[model samples]
Structure formats: structure tokens, C-alpha cells
Target chain A: MEIKKTSLNKLHQSNNAKFVEFAGYEMPIQYSKGIIEEHKFTRSHSGIFDVSHMGQLFIYGDESLTEELEKIFPLDLKNLKQNCSKYSFLMNEDAGIYDDLIITKIEEGYLIILNAACKDKDFEILSNLLGSKFKMNLDNNRSLIAIQGPKSVEILNSIINGVDQLNFMTGNWFNSDNQKLFVTRSGYTGEDGFEISITNDKAEKFVENLIEKGAKLIGLGARDTLRLEAGLCLYGHELDINKTPVEANLRWAISKSRLSNGGFIGSKKIMNQMQDGASQIRVGIKPEGRLIAREKTKIFNDTDKQIGEITSGTFGPSVNGPIAMGYVDKEFSKVDTKILLEVRGKKHPANVCALPFYKKNYVKGVN
Target chain B: MSEVKFSKEHEWITLEGDVATIGITKHATEMLGDIVFAELPEKGSNVEKDGTAGVVESTKAASDVYTPVSGEVVDTNQAIVDDPSKINEDPEGAAWFFKLKMKDQSEMDSLMNKEEYDKFAKESAS
Candidate 1:
């Protein structure tokens, strides 16, 4: 099958980006500046990304739409004010996660943003759950772009007005050159930025305008390292159908009202797990040697007993050392606990560290 | 004076008198992307041809460097060890990984010349 190319494919190619196939899309993995430079650029300056492959959906119905959504997700949608967004998940009957997503309560309805690779599966699962109670419109034609870095707001302010008023996790509809679009103050880079949802017809022009305004286009290579350093979870790596939010350290997404009301899908099992604690918990690892502990590396205790496996690992550009996140037995998931990572048949000493291995500079005053 | 030779794994060795200077080729450095770190063999250590001599790591992947010719490592480039990006910037010159005292002169003939190595790199990319 032919891989789908993003609208900015040519732009990336012109900039000499190394393209790679990711989630059925031909995307840029790095550029001429290389991954380290790009990763540092995002932290120090501004980095733009073409994330149009991510899924965007609109769920509309009567006043009961939020009530119906509450039945499937564990978030407290009743208190979700308009234009505010919440990170949530779709759970199976057994309380296992189907997919993790961000749901924004829009003016007229709900806007759900999902992982690119899990889009179809998520839609099918949500459709089967809702079943005639709500109308679901898939906006696959719309493209998504992220402008991330410390200078993102300053760069965006030069073009769009009133964007400074948007706090974290909030969104607003805006018009640019007679084109309608939605902008959200959210990003995966752990930096303060915005994710712009634009029509396919206007994506090219919108990206060009942003680039012309001094935004450096980053690729998947840097995006992975940036998020990894931030201790943010990638969908397939940190979360999957077999894991729940409680195990993935995503308890913040589970609202207090949902814990009390207990009306949502998998609430009994999820809440029970929350109360009793999960068997395995995600923890960060800082490897002693320069050799990186890549994905699938085994984590062992001092006694050489297998404890966990690395889900994501890399030579973090920001951290300047090998860093990883993995699921360890609950008993060993304490801060500063020493562990060992078996990399290439040799054991390297590691220490359990705090999350967000690199502190995020999301809003200077807020964070 | 002897001509430079390259291995299929992209390592290059140049023989001058009884000493051979070794490092990765430009093609290899470009494919590895931004190199973050390198593990080098200690000076005065013996290595065998076609054996693992050291390691080179990029942000995306890590690979072992094989000794193209058997010798005793006499000296190592401390500059590349300090900043691995030198391999990406000048793989052929300043990025030379190590200097070795050749144990067998016949081992030099086993590697390919510039023309053959260039062709091999192009075909392998395809």
C-alpha cells in the first residue's frame, strides 16, 4: 500500500529532511540540522511539527451529549466548562484502555483528538459504546500542526490576536485570512505551545505562514526525544490496550467526581485498581553508562531478578545521558531506587528518578 | 606510501609505513545521523581483523565498529571522544578514530579501494 504523505511533505523534503514511514504516513524523522540540534532547538527556541496524521472527531447531540460521553470515559464531563480540554481514555469492558485521547468541550459540541495509529480502532470502539445516542463526525480531512518551544507564544502572538489569553488545556476558534480554524493551548513536547487544527485546503498556507514567522520545522526524531525527556508517554509505548491509566501514571486524568459518581464505563474496576494500587507502575531510569538502554531492555533488581522492561529509552539530548521509562514491580517503584538495565547482554547500573526527567517550561509563572 | 582501503561496514584504513590509521567512512557517518557518543578501544590494546573493536552511537541507533585490519592500537583520537559530532563533520580527516601498528601487511589488500567502496556504498543504499 502507498503511504499517505502529509500536506507539508514537499516542504520537509525541500528542507532536506530524512523521511521515514510512521503510522502509515511518510513523515520526516530528522532534518539537515540533525536530531540533537532539533531537540535542543525545541527546548531553547521554537519548533513546528506536522502532526496531521492524528485523528480529530466531533461528537454532537442534545444536552445529554456530555452525559453520554461520561458513560464511556472516566473524566468528570459535568464540570468540564466550555472551551476547556481534558486528557481522557476509552476503556474496554474489562477496564483496560482502548486508547488515550484529549477531549475538548467546544462551543456547540465535543472535539476529541486521538492517536494517529489508533484512530480507526478508537472510532469503532466509541461508536459501539454510544450506539445511536450521539452523532459522530470524523474530521480526517483536517490537518494538525504543533508549534512548540519557549518562544512559541511570542511567535504566535505576532500573527494571531488574543491567543495570550488561552491558558493551558484551553482552546478557541480563530480566523486567519478568511480561513476558519481551531487553536488549542496543548502540546506533547512538555513545552508551552499550541496545536492548530486547520482544513486540508488551508494547511499548506498556514504552515508556510508559521515557517515564514521564524518557526523551525522539527521531525519525528526530535519529537520522540523531546517527549521522552519530558517524561510524557507515547501511545503505543507507555499506554496500550492491556494497560489502564492507573498503571501508566495518568491518575491526573481521572477526575474526582468520576471517582464518587461511579457512572462511567470501567469505573468499578478502574477505581478499584486506583484504591488498591496497580501491580506495576511506570518509573524513570537514568543509566550509569553512556550506552543507552533502548526499548525492550530488561530491568533487573540487585539480585539479578527480572523486575520490568523498558518501554522507551534513548540518549536524551536534554539530559545529556541515557534515560528511560519502564514499568517496574510496584515494590521497587520508589524515587532514587537503584536498578540494573541489561543492555546487549551486559548489566548497566541505573537509578530510579522522578518523572519529567527534564523540568518543563510550559508557562513561566504557572509551572 | 600505501593507498587507503574501506570495509563493507564503512570503516577506512590507511597504511603509512607500518602504521595504519582507522576510522568510519563519510557514507557511514551520514547514515548514522547525529552521533552522540563513541566507545573507543584503549591505546596499546591488540585487535583482530573482522572483530569488534569499538562502538558508535547515534541518537536513533547504536552500532559496533569492526577492525578491518589486525594490529595493536597505538593511539586514539581524544578529540572525537570529546565531541562525537566530529565524525559527522569530518569523517575522513579529523575524525580518524585510532592509529595502529600493523601486524600483517597482507591484511591491507583485503579491503576495497575508493572506487570500489563508493560503488558498494551506493548499491547498498539502494
Candidate 2:
């Protein structure tokens, strides 16, 4: 298969980015300043991420569309306000996550942001479930760019104008450069940021403008470190076909009203796990000293019984230490629980800790 | 002290009497960016030629550091283990990994020199 490239491929190369193959696309791993510098830069200043490879799915429908989607997702679409967003999961009958996404209610219908690797399959599955009743376009002509950090609002609001008024988890369409762009105050990094949906042809120029406004381009390497420090989940690593939202400790995302009625696709299994609890649950693991227990590294009990495995682990530049997230037995998932991580054929001591290793600075409300 | 020799594994070694000091080359550090963790072989342990003696981990991944020649481990740098970023800052100087007492002095014969390793490093990277 031919490797794919995003609209900003030339820009990344010109900035001396080191490339890596991610989800079949040749994406930049890190730029000239490297991961640590980029990660820190995003925390202190604004950093731009070229997330164009992700899926921007627009589904247009009427009143009946909301009714039908409520049966598929566990969200209360009837009560959800326009231009507001919610973090959700597309699941199977067994409650296993197909992909985790952010769905925003727009003026016409809903726009869903999906993981790049699973977008095609998600489109097929949704098309089958909806049975052609609505119009769905998995847009390839659009590009997604995320600008994140402490100074993101000031930097972005300068160009787009009126963007600083947006509260977290909300979005609105604005006219910029003679085009309509859907700008949302949300991002993967646990910083104040915005994700902008713009036409592919204008992406490079848009990013260059952001650079002129003091935002720097960051790569996937720093993105991983930043998100890991924030305790966010990645699709292939923290979420998969075998993992359910309940086991992943994301039960809060499921709407309370939907839990009682139990009409959604995975409601039965979800309710069961909610009541009886899951066998394994996700938790934050902090290794003692500088030992890094990477993905698939085994978690063990004091007596050497294998209990779980690490899903994501890395050196968090903000925290200046090694951090990891993994599934441990539900009995051992409590904060401050002592656990062991097996790295390079040796067991190292670690502790189960509360998530968000670095505190989030989200702008929740202005009024 | 003598002229430093390099191994294909990107480690540099300098022999003084029978004690040979070794550390990963600067080229190796450039390849592995932002090192965060390190582990050294135990002192008094005998290591075989080209065997794993230590480990270094960057934010991206972990790599096993290899010994170019067989010897008994005499000293290890605790400073690098305490602060691995020094490996990125000065890998060739203050970040020397370990010192080994030679099991066979002639074991250094086949290793690459500075000019040879430069060419090898360039070819291997491409």
C-alpha cells in the first residue's frame, strides 16, 4: 500500500520534522526542538498540531435523526444544546468500544471527530445501522488542526476573532479568509485549546498564520507525551475491541438519563458492569524513580501473580517523571495501592495514583 | 589513557592499563532523543563480547546498550543513572557508562576507529 500524507507534509519537512508511519500515514514524530521541548512549549505557550489525518464526519438529518442516534450512542441528544459537545464511544452489543469520539451538535445535524485508523470502519458500521435514512459524509477535503496551550486563546482569537468567547466543549462556525470554519474549544492535550476544521487547500496558509501569531508546530511524539501527562486515552493503545467504556473508567461519559431507560446498543452490558463492577479497570500507575514501563508491560501482585498490562506509558515533560496508564484488577485499582511493574525481566515497585498527572487548566465558563 | 575506539553498536571505549572506559557515542544519543532513564550492569559481573551490559530509555522507547568487548565490570557511572539527560548533553565526556577490566586485551582488535565509525554511522542511518 502507498503511504499517505497530510496537507502539511511539505511544511513539516521544511521545519526538519522526523517522520514516522502512523495509521498508514507518514506523520511527523518530532520537529527540530524534539519532544521534550515541544511538550513543554505547549504547556507554557501555544503549540499547533496537524491532526488532518483524523476523520471529520458530518451527518446531516432532521428530528428523526436525533431519535435514531440516541438508540446507538448513550447520549441524551434531545437535551443536548446546539453547538455543545460530548465525549462518547461507538460500541458493539458486547459493550466493547469500537472507537471513542467527540460529537458536537451543529445547526444542521451533528459532526463527529474520529480516530484516523478506525474512521473508515466506523463509517461503514454507522451506514449499516442507519440504513441510508440520513446523509453522512466522511469528509476528506477538510483538515483538522488543534492549537493548544496557555496562550492559545489570545493567539487564535487574533486571527479568527470572537473565538475567545467560546466555552470549553462548545463550538460555532465562523467566517475566516472567506471560508466557513467550525471552531471548537476542545483538544487532546489537557490545556486551553481549540480544534479548527478548515478546507484542505487553506491548511498550510492557516498554520503559517498561526506560526506568525506565535504558535509552533508540534509532532505526534510530543502529542503522546502531553496527552499521557493529562491522562487521556489513545485509541489503539488505551481503547480497543476488547475494552469497554466501563472497564476503561469512562462511565461518566454515558448520560445518566440513558442509563435508566437502557435502550442504547450496549446498555445491557453497561448496566451490568455498572452494578456488579468489571474484573479489570483502568488506573494511573507511577513507577518509582525513572523506570519506564511501556505499553504491554505486565502488572504483577506482590507475590508475582500477573494481574494486568500497561496500555500507555512515557516520560511526561511537564511532570518531569515517568507516568503510565494501565488496566489492573478492580480489587487493586484504588489510588495509593502498591503494585509491581515488570520491565526488562525485572519487577519494579509502583503506585496506583489519581489521574491527570498534570492538572488541567480548562476554561469552563465565563458567565 | 589511549585513543578511543568505537563499536558498530555506537559505543566508544578508551583503554587505560587493563581498565577500559566505555560510553555510548554522541551519534547514538542523537539517534535516541531526550533520554529519561538509564540502567547499568552490576559491578564485578563478567560480561561477554557484544553482550547487553546496560539499558537507556528515551521518551520514545528503550534500547539495550551492548558491550563491545568481554571484561569484568569494575565501575559504573551512578550520575548518569540519577540524571539520564546528561547522556544527551555530553554523552562522550561526563556520561561514560562503565569501566571494565579486560578479560582479553586483544578483544578490541576488530572494533571500528573514528573515521571508520563515521562512515558506518552514516550508512547505517540511511
Candidate 3:
């Protein structure tokens, strides 16, 4: 099957982007500046990412859709305030995470933004649960662009108003003339940023305008490195159908109210993991040497006993060294613990570090 | 006088008397994209022709560097190991990966010269 193209596909080509097939879409892996340059630029200044392939669906109904949604996910959606977004998991009946999603409470019902690769299955899962009461509208016509860096607000504020006021995880639809833009102060890069949802016809122009204001166009390669540095979980890498939220260090997304009430799908197994502690936990690993211990590299302890394996690994431009994250035996999950990663048949010493390899610089609460 | 030869795997070997200097070709470096790390075989190690001698890692993935001929690793380039990006800068010269004392000079006859390698690279790309 031919790969699908986003609205800004032509723009990426014109900007000399190196295209790679990602999640069934012809996405840019990096521009002419390369991944290392793009990664560093996003950390220092700002970069624009075309994440339009992500699933953006709207579920609407007269009565709140929370009751129906609660049965499928692990979050208490009933109390989710309007315009506030909560990052939660779409869990299966057996407690495995189906997919991680962002559900923002809208005026009519809710809008769920999910992983691009899992969109089809996730859509089916949602439609099956609330199809009778809620009307699920898949928004394919809208393009999602993430503007991230210290200068993100300055770049975006020039085109629209009041976007700078939106706090992290809060979204508001801004209207100018006839075009409506939904801007959210949330991103994967662990930096101050905003994700703007715009219509297809205006998407290219929107990106061009941002470029004119000095936002470099970043691609999937830098996006992966940036998110990895931030300790954010990528769907296939850090999460899968077999891993529970507790194992992936995502218990924070499971609200206390939901845990106490005990009414969400997979609540039994999830609650059990929360109470008893998971056998394996995700931890960050910093390779002691220059060699990068990529995904699937085995992890070992001082005695050379196999402890775990790396799920995602890369040379972190900001960190100035190779970094990785993987699941390890909970007994060896403490920070600063010594570990060895076998890369290409050679063992390299590594240190277990705290998550969010880089400090988050989010602009919170109207800052 | 020196003569350069290419392997099917995109490694280049330059022969000068009994010693051969080896590194990945520019074509290989371009395909790998922004090489971040290089693992070279230790000095004095014996390597078989077409055997995996080292590894090159990019941000996206890792690839093995195969020896084009049987040889004893005489020296490894510590500079390229210290800064892998040097390979991207000058893959054929300053970024040379290692030096090997050739076991048999006749192996050069089986390798591709500059002209033949160019044609092979084009064919492989297409």
C-alpha cells in the first residue's frame, strides 16, 4: 500500500526534509540540518514538528460521555474540567495498555488524541464502547503542528492572541476572521511548547509563517531523541499491549479518585500492581562510554547477570552522551545504580538515572 | 604508490605495500546518516575476509563494519572512536577506521576499484 501524506508534505519536501515512512505516513525524519542539529536547535531555540498523522477524534453526546469512557480507560473522566486535558491510558480488560491518549473535555463531549499507529484500533475500541450514545468524529482534515523550545511562545504569539496565556495541558480554540485554531500548551519535548491544530487548507501557510518568524522544521528523528531525553514514553518503545501502566511508570496518570472508586477497566490488575509493586520498572540508563546501546541491547549487573534490556536508546545531543531507557528488574531500579549494557557483543558500563533525563522547562499556569 | 579498492558492503581499503588502511566509503556514511559512535577491533586481532570487524552506530540504528580481506589488525584509529562525527566529515581519509597487515595481497583482485565501485553503488541504489 502507498504511504499517506500529510497536508504539509509538500512543504517538508520543499524544505529539503529527509522523508521516512513512520506509522503508515511519509513523515520527515530530519531536514537538511540533520538530527543532531535539529535536536540541539529545539533545545536552544524552537522547532516545528508536523505531527498531523496523530489521531484526533471527537466523541460527542448530550449526557457526559465520561461514564462510557471510564469503562475503557483507567482515568475518571466525569470530573475532567472543560478545556482541561488529561493524559491517560486506553487499557484492555486484562490491564495491558492498549494505547496512551490525551482526552480533553470539550463543550459537547471529549476529544481524544492518540498514537498514529494505534489510531485504527483505538477508534474501534472507542466506537465499540460508546457507539450507541456518542458520535465519534475522526478529524482527518485538521493538521497538528507542535512548536517547541524556549522561544515557542514568542513565535506562536505573533500570529495569534491569548495562546501565551494557556497553561500546560490546557487548550483553547482561538478564532481569527473565519479560521479557528485550537492551541494547546503541551508537547513531548520536555520544553515550553504548544501544539496547534489547524485546518488542512491553512496548514502549509501556518508553518511557513512560523518559519518566517524563525522556527526550524524538525522531523521524527529529533522528535524521538527529544522525547527520549524528556523520559516521555513512545507507544511501541516504552509501551505495548503486554505492559501495564504501573510497569511503564505511568501510575501518575491513573488519578487517585479513579483508584479509590475502583470503577475503570483493568482496575483490578492495575490496582494490584500499584499496591504490590511491579516486578519490572522502566529506568533511564546513561552509557558510561561513547558507544550507544541501542534498543534491544541487553542490560547486566556487576556479576554479569542479565537484568533487563534497552527499549529506546540514542545519542542525546543535549545530554552530550548516549542515553537509553528500558525495563529492569525492580530490585535494581534505584537511581545511580551501576549497570552494564551489552552493545554489539561488548559490555559498556552504565548508570541507572532518574527519569526525564533532561529537566522540564514547561511554561505553567499563565507564565 | 597507493591503490584504493571497495567492498560490496561499502567499506574502502587503500593498499600501500603490505599494510592496508580501511574505512567506510562516503556512500556508506551518507546512508547511515550522522554517525555517532564507532567500535573498532582491537590491535593484533585476526579477521577473516568479509568478517564483521567493527560496528558503526547512528541515531536511528547500528550497522556492522565488515573486513574486506583476511588480515591482522595492526592499529585502530582512536580519533574516530573518540569522535564518530569525523567519519561523516572525511570518510576516506582522516576518518580511516583501522590499519591491517594483509594476509594475502591477491585479495585486492577480488575487490572493486573506484570506477567499478561507482557503478556497483549506483546499481545497488537503484
Off by over 4 Å in 2: none
Best by lDDT: 2
- The C-alpha RMSD in Å for every predicted model, in order, reads 2.0, 0.8, 1.6
lDDT of 2 by residue, A1-367 (tens): 9999999999999999999999989999999888999999999999999999999999999779899999999999999999999999999999999999999999989999999999999999999999888999999999999999999999999999999999999999999989999999999999999999999999999999999999999999999999999999999999999999999999999999999988999999999999999999999999998899999999999999999999999999889999999999999999999999999889999999999999999998854
Candidate-wise lDDT, in order: 0.88, 0.95, 0.90
Answer with 1 or 2, whichever has the higher lDDT: 2
lDDT string for model 3 (B8-117, tens) is 99999988888999999999988888889899998999999999999998888899999998899999999998999999999998999989999899998999999999
Lowest lDDT block of 10, candidate 1 chain A: A358-367
Candidate 3 docks at the CAPRI level of medium
> Please, what are the lDDT tens digits per residue for candidate 3 over residues A1-367?
9999999999999999889899999999988878999999999999999999999998886445777777777776777788899899888877888899888887878888989999999988877877676688889999999999999899899888788889899898898548998888899999999998899999999999999999999999999999999999999988999999999988899889888767788999988889999999999999997878888999999998999989999998889889999999999999999999886667888999998889999877675
Worst 10 residues of 2 chain A by lDDT: A358-367
Ranking by DockQ: 2, 3, 1
lDDT of 2 by residue, B1-126 (tens): 888899999999999999999999999998999999999999999999999999999999999999999999999999999999999999999999999999898988999899999999999999
Highest DockQ model number: 2
lDDT, candidate 1, B1-126, per-residue tens: 578899998999888999999999999988999887787899989999999888898999889999999899999998887788789999999999988899898988878999999999999987
Candidate 3 contains a number of clashing pairs equal to 0
Give the per-residue lDDT digits (tens) of candidate 1, residues A106-140: 98789999988998888898888788777898787
